[model samples]
Target: MLIYPDERLAVFIDGANLYATARALEIEIDYKALRAHFAEQSRLVRTFYYTAILEDQEYSPLRPLIDWLDYNGFTLVTKPVKEFTDEHGRRKIKGNMDIEIAVDMLNIAENVDHIVLFSGDGDFRRLLEAVQRRGVRVTVVSSNSTQPSMIADELRRQADQFIDIVDLAPIIGRKGPRRQHHAHYDEREETTREFEDAED
Candidate 1:
């Protein structure tokens, strides 16, 4: 939340991670409002959203949301999800965007004065450190409001500032009944589950 109006800022959103976090908190994020909130805080440069799509599906549940974000102010970076069977013969989907996010963040670090990362994955702790070393201030947006706490302790500690999504709910959360993209939310949850299972 500590932002200066003159600072150059960029937002990196891990789509699946954010969706899971918000769902855990029972909050629906208004993407427009979320963008506006950050734009108001600083010299917003860009917002990048990363996700993976199931290429083989006849009609992807996430297509609507993906299209919406693409038409919006967000930069979409996505790839096809790989479906494979595990050693135990269990089907799994692998679609982690961690590398893509890291590469983009590092590429933009020198140009931006600040970066706002929306993810709770502990894997990014070192990435935050690297950005900070380059004189870029990093703010992590996630939450500890859930029963198990969505934000990783080490990731929170690595950030120059940590803003809980719970606190941001009032400003960027949906006001009334959810929009038509409700189905996309369900798909995100399922994707998160599959991604985690694959990682395990």
Candidate 2:
């Protein structure tokens, strides 16, 4: 559950992870609404969203969304994408903002009572533990609804609470006339399906 109401809260969003979660849920997060949802529940000290931008290119499709979040209430922490060649000679791009996220969370530990982390990268399990050691209650928001599950098992267990992203839709769902796309939903039950099945 979202322990919102009276707790002092801060949201640390792994932008890419959040996008995938919402995409899997077949919804676009109304960033404005998401802010309001938390504000209504607690004192929202800061809203941090971390992402990597492809500034090397003249154009990137995700630019607009990033711009909106920056202009709005979010504190945007972004970096450039790194291009590399794998052993197989395949080109790949990787963008990591883990260090930034971990640093910001530690910095804010004393400022807030509850910390909401929106990621499922499994690697963050240690980060969660560290934050909790400071007496900050942590809540992880990701999805088991995604194929292999977006929320990592260790992270869920480490946090004071685990909030499945599916449960947040009503607070963050689209408003106005929605031109629905085929949600790209799974062929099998989201929860019953094994994590390996959705790793794609």
Candidate 3:
């Protein structure tokens, strides 16, 4: 995280992207710790978390974590997944929150001196470039430590700084007693697996 105490800052979290990144690092981020880590670095004005939900089941798999984040200080941004059948008759859910993340970052660029982005999707390269044009410094957080780096080459190169998620373990990983893998959310769920083609 490229944070200086005096700088004004905000965080934009791409939910699915972050979950997978953290998993690749073999760590679970304590949300409260993650937020406090930034708060200590700057005057954190906002932390926006964006994700898509599949409504097929009566109860979505992510409801618990989603509810927790909303009740916390973080701003929860979500969109419903649209179901469609492709030409091959395979059902796919379409719900990408990239626009939401990009728009919020640009909207607040003037108010913030720094941005902490938690996803490595290459598509955000243009967004980062645009925000830089508006005079905001960007810190991209993802891992190159994975088998095939989670961050895009251009996005990582374009960022003012890139902080691999593994490096953040000591700063944000779980502390104290944890019971029965209580913190483990179902990583194999559909939405979580959708990133298999992240490079595709």
Candidate 4:
């Protein structure tokens, strides 16, 4: 977590990926605290959060959290999830936000001195490299404490700094019991599970 108070900082959060990583560590993130933690570190530019919604549902499980984030300081980037049947006749959903995140990061790179990525997906290795080439420092935050390790080796290597999410648990984790079923927390868990099932 090398940071300077004068540096301009931007945060990009892969909502589902982060939710899964936190869950694996048996910790519930205090979103407000997470934002404040970074805002205190440097000149906060903007925080972007990405997710996909099952649009066909009358009321999505993610709606509440989405609304809260939108109303808060986070810039929400979302799209409708596509439902389709696989070759094996299994119904699946597809809604990857990699392109959106990459494009946004690239577009904002010149303005920010540092970029904080809150995801462990290996697919973003090239994106981080590209941003670094533009002289913007990149910090990747994800857990390496899980059985299989939540952060990808390549992605971790690509980042200028790698911070394990577990280390920040004390600062950004919820203060109550570990497994309480708060509505927003349950929604995030369900949404992450849905994405995982689709990928599988």
Best by TM-score: 1
RMSD of each candidate relative to the true structure = 1.0, 5.8, 2.3, 2.1
TM-score of each: 0.97, 0.85, 0.91, 0.93
Q: Report the lDDT tens digits of candidate 1 across residue range 61-107.
A: 98988899899899999999999998899888999999999999999
Error of 1 at 154 (Å): 1.0
Clashing pairs in 2: 148-195
Q: After superposition, how far is residue 119 of candidate 1 from its true place, in Å?
A: 0.5
How many residue-pair clashes does candidate 2 contain? 1
Find the 10 residues in a row with the least total lDDT in model 4.
Answer: 178-187
- Could you arrange the candidates by lDDT from highest to lowest? 1, 4, 3, 2
lDDT of 3 at 89: 79
lDDT of 3 by residue, 12-108 (tens): 9998888888877777778888998999889999989898887667766677777877888999999887676767877666667888998888899
**Worst lDDT window (10 residues) for model 2?**
182-191
Q: After superposition, which runs of candidate 3 have C-alpha atoms over 4 Å from their true positions?
A: 176-184, 195-200
Number of clashes in every candidate structure?
Answer: 0, 1, 0, 0
The residue ranges of model 2 lying beyond 4 angstroms of the native Cα positions read 2-4, 177-200
Indicate which candidate wins on lDDT: 1
Superposed on all Cα atoms, model 3 deviates from the true structure by an RMSD in Å of 2.3
TM-score of model 4 vs. true structure: 0.93
Q: Which of candidates 2 and 3 reaches a greater TM-score?
A: 3
- lDDT by residue for model 4 over 145-185, one digit each (tens)? 99999899999999999999999999989897643233565
* CA lDDT scores, all candidates in order: 0.92, 0.77, 0.83, 0.89
